[model samples]
Target: MSTHRILIAGFGGQGVQFAGRLLAHVGMYVGKEVSYLSSYGPEMRGGTSNCSVQISDKFIASPLVLEPTELVVMNGPSLEKFEKTVVPGGRIYIDSSIVAKPAVRSDIEPHPIPATALAEEMGLGRLANVIFCGYLIKKLDLCPLSALPAILKEVVSAKRPELLEGNLQALALGFSM
Candidate 1:
C-alpha cells in the first residue's frame, strides 16, 4: 500500500502540468488510483503554474495536495512557495540550473539536478520537465524503466510525433542521473 502525493511547480511554459499529467498516466497504467489537479496564474506563458498528482494503491479522496510527499520545483519562486509544503522526510527535486537557492528545511531530502542544463546540453532544452519526470520515475520506483517508452509513445506520438526521440533521450539521460 503505497501513496505518493506529488506537487510539481514552475513557470507556465515549463511543462509543470504536463509532468503531472504524465505521472497521472503512469499511475493509471500501473493500476493505481490517481488524481490530478492543475492551477495557473492569469498570464499563460510566463506566469506561475503548478499541478498536484496523487497516486495510491487505494482510493484518492481529493486532488488537492496540501502536504506533498514528493515536490518538484523548477524555479526559485516555486521552490520558495512550495518548499515548506513538503512533509517531513519527504523528497524535493530541484532544477539547479534555474533555481540558485537551496532548500531551507533540513528534515526533508533535497535532490538538486541540473535538469535544464542537462537537457540543453543534449539539445533538448524544451524537454527539461520530462527529464525531471524521468528522475522522479527512477527515484520513486513508480514504474519500470522498460515501460516508459511505450507510455511515452502513447502520450506524445499523436500530438507531437517528432519529439518522441528527443523525449526518450531526455528520459534516459535523467534516469542515468
Candidate 2:
C-alpha cells in the first residue's frame, strides 16, 4: 500500500482510539511515516469517539482524514455519521454485532465482522477493538501475524501485563476469521 488514510469511529468505551493507535504503531513498526489524531465527545465512556490515522511511504501532509481510504465503525451511529466520508472503492469494516444495519454506500466495499460478538464469546469483550485491528491487519496484508506478539508486548507490557495473553488470543481469533 502506498498511503492509507484510515478513520476509526465508535462510542468512547469501544476502544476506537486504541485501535487507531495500534494501527499507527504497526505502521511505525513497519518503517512507514505515520500520524494519528483522535477526537472524542465530552462524556468519557459513552460519548462519540473517533480517530484519524495516516500511514504513507511519503511525507504526510495532514493528520485529518476528510476522506478515508479505510473506515472502521463500531456502532450504528458511527456508521451513519461516517459512511459517506469514505472515498469511492474504499473499504469499510463494520462491527456487525453493534451495527445491525448494513452500510448504504454502494461505492465503497463493506466488510461486516462480528467483532464485538466474537470478543464477548471469547470472554474478551473489551478487546473487540484489538480483534478488529487484527482483522484489518490480515485483510489489508499490512503486516505478518508473526509480528504481533512483539507489538502486543510493547503495547501492554508497561501497565497491563495481565492483558497480554488475552490480547494475543483475541488477535488470533480475529485473524483466523
Candidate 3:
C-alpha cells in the first residue's frame, strides 16, 4: 500500500540491471510511479554491480535506494554489502546456492532461494535474476500476481515463447518457496 523500494545487487551480467528494469516496467504497466537505476564501471560483469527500483502509488522522487524495503543479492559480496543497510523488518533474497552465509541479525528476514539452480533446472540459466525477482515479489507482496505473467511476456523474449513459460514456472516456484 505504501512506497516500496527494492535493491537488486550482484556481479555485472548477472541480470541485476534487467531485473530492476523489468520490475520498473511492470510498475509502469500497473500505473504506479517507478524509478530504476544501475551502476556500470570498467569492471562490468566480473565486478560488483547494483540496481535499484522504487515503486509507489504516489510520486517517485528518486532512483537511489540506500535503504530498501527489500534487497536481492546474486552473490556473496552483494549479500554482505547490502545486509547491514537493509531496513529493519525488511526482506532479503539471496541465491542460496551461491551465497553460503546470512546476516548476523535475526530481525531482518532473509529468503534463501536457489534461483540459479532453479533456472538451470528450468533450462534457462540466464534467468537467475528473473527467478530472484519472482521470489522478491512473492516475499514483498509488492505487486499483483495477475500482473506477473504479463510482465514476463512484456519484458522477456517473445521469440522464445518457451522462455516465458519457463519464467512463469520460475516465478511460481519462487512464490512456493
Candidate 4:
C-alpha cells in the first residue's frame, strides 16, 4: 500500500489545521486509511500552526510526518520553516499574498497562489484556506471535485450556515485558477 503525506503550515488564524482536516476527511470518505496531527504555538491567533496528514490504501503506521510528499505554506515563515522538509520531487504550494520569496529548491515544484488577495476580492478574506484546499485538490488530483460539496456541507457549522456558499465559491474559484 502506498501512503501520501501532506504538511500544511501557516499562522494560527490561517486555518492550516482546518485544511488538513478537510483532506483527511476526504481521504476517509473515499475509503483510504487516514491520520491527521496538528501542532501550534501558544501565542494563539498570530502564532504558528501546522498539521500533518497521511492518507494510504493500507493501515497507517504513524500520524507523524517528517518529510512530506506535498507542502502547503501560507506565510513566509512557514515557507522558510517547512521548505527543507519536503521530499525531493515533492510539490509546494505557497500563499503568494504572504510569501513573496520563492523556494530555493530545484527538485520540487512550486505553486504560488495569491490566496488572501483573491479571497478578499470575493468578500470572504478568511476563506483563503478553503481556496488553498481547492487548489491542492485540483492540482494533486487528491479527490474528486464532486465530493467536496457534500463533505463541506457536513463539516460546516450549523450556526454559520451562510459561510458554506462562500466556501464553495472560493473553492470553485481556486479550482478554476
Candidate 5:
C-alpha cells in the first residue's frame, strides 16, 4: 500500500477540481484513505483552479499537497505553475492540445494527452475532463475500470442524465488512448 499525492490544475471551466474529486472518490470507494482539497479564483470560467488529492492505504495525515507525486495540467499556465512541483520519477499528465510547451524536468515521466482535441472529435468538448479521468486511471492503475461508470452515474447530475452515456464513451476512448 503506497501513498499517492496528485495535483490537478487548469482554468476554472476545465474541471480541475472535478477531476481531483473523481480520483479521491474512487480511492475511497476502493477502501483507501483519501483526501481532496481545492482552490479557485473568483473568476468563474477563466480563473486559475487547482486541487490536491492524497490517497494512501493508511490514514491520511493532511489534505494539503506541497509536492505532488502525480500531476495533471490542462493548460500552459498550470503546467508552468505545477510542473516543478512534481516529485522526481513521478508522472505528469498534460493536455497536449492546449499546452504547447513540455515540462522542464527530465526526471519525471510526462504523458501528453490531446484531451481537448479528442473531446472535440467526439462532438462533446466538455467531456475532456472525463476523458482525462479515464486516461489518468489507466495510467496510474488507480482503480478498476468497471468502477468508473458507477462513479460517473453517482456524480453526474439528474438534470443532465443524458450525458452519462457520453461520459462513459469518452472515458473508454481515453482509456484506449
Candidate 6:
C-alpha cells in the first residue's frame, strides 16, 4: 500500500485525537505501518489542536506531516491555517457545520460536509467527530467501506454498543451524502 499522510485539525475537545486514533488502529489492523500523534499544550483545550497520522506499507521516515496527502479541516480557522501547506492534488475535507466560509486554493480537492449538523440531527451532539471520520473514510477511500463497522466496534464498548452502531450509521450517512 502507498503511504498516506492524513491530518485532522480543529480546536481541542472536537475528538481530533480520537479520529486519528481510529485511523491508526485501522492501519495497524490491516497490517500497515502507522504513526499517530496529537499536539497538545495547556491551551489545547481552549485553543487549537491537531493530529497527524501516516499509514504506509513501507517504513515511515517522519511522523510530522510537512506536506500531508489529505487534510481533514474540522474548523474554519484550521482550514485557513493549513490550506497553504497541502500539496497539489491533495484532498481536503471540511466540516461545514461548524466552519464557515472555508477558503480555497485552486490545487486541492475540497469536500465539505455538515458534520456537526448531521450529528445534531441524529441527536448526537457530541458525535460531530464521528461524522467527519465517516466522511473522510468515504471520500478519501481510506480503506474498504466494509472495514468501518468493524473499526467502530473495535473502538466502542459492549456496555454501549449502540454508540458504535450509531457511529456506523453516521459513517454510512456521511459516505452517502
Query: Which candidate number maximizes lDDT?
Result: 1
TM-score: model 4 vs. ground truth: 0.92
How much lDDT does candidate 2 score? 0.88
Give the C-alpha miss distance for residue 60 in model 4, angstroms. 1.3
lDDT of 3 by residue, 1-177 (tens): 788899998887788888898888877887889999886655355678898899899988877899988888898888877898889999888888788886676889878888888788877777888777777676667676777887778888678787777677767776666
lDDT of 5 by residue, 1-177 (tens): 578998888888888877788788778788889999887445335578888899899888888887998898998998888888888999999999999998889999999988999899989768788888888778778777788888887777879999889888888887778
- Cα lDDT of model 6 by residue, 12-45, tens digit: 7788888888878778877889998887756476
* CA RMSD of each candidate after superposition: 1.6, 1.7, 2.1, 1.9, 1.8, 2.0
lDDT of 2 by residue, 6-76 (tens): 99998887888888988898888889999999974453355889999998999999899989999999989
Q: What's the C-alpha lDDT at position 43 in model 5?
A: 35
Give the per-residue lDDT digits (tens) of candidate 4, residues 1-177: 367899999888788888899888878888889999987446345588889999888888879888998899998898888999999999899998888899899999988899999999889869899998888778767677888898787668878998889888887887778
TM-score of each: 0.94, 0.94, 0.87, 0.92, 0.92, 0.88
Model 5 clash pairs are none
Model 6 alpha-carbon miss at residue 100, Å: 1.4
Poorest 10 consecutive residues by lDDT, candidate 4: 39-48
Clashing residue pairs for model 6: none
lDDT of 1 by residue, 28-85 (tens): 8888899999874453455888899999988889899989999999989889889999
Cα lDDT of model 4 overall? 0.85
**Which regions of candidate 6 fall more than 4 Å away from where they truly are?**
41-46, 157-162
Clashing pairs in 4: none
Off by over 4 Å in 1: 40-46
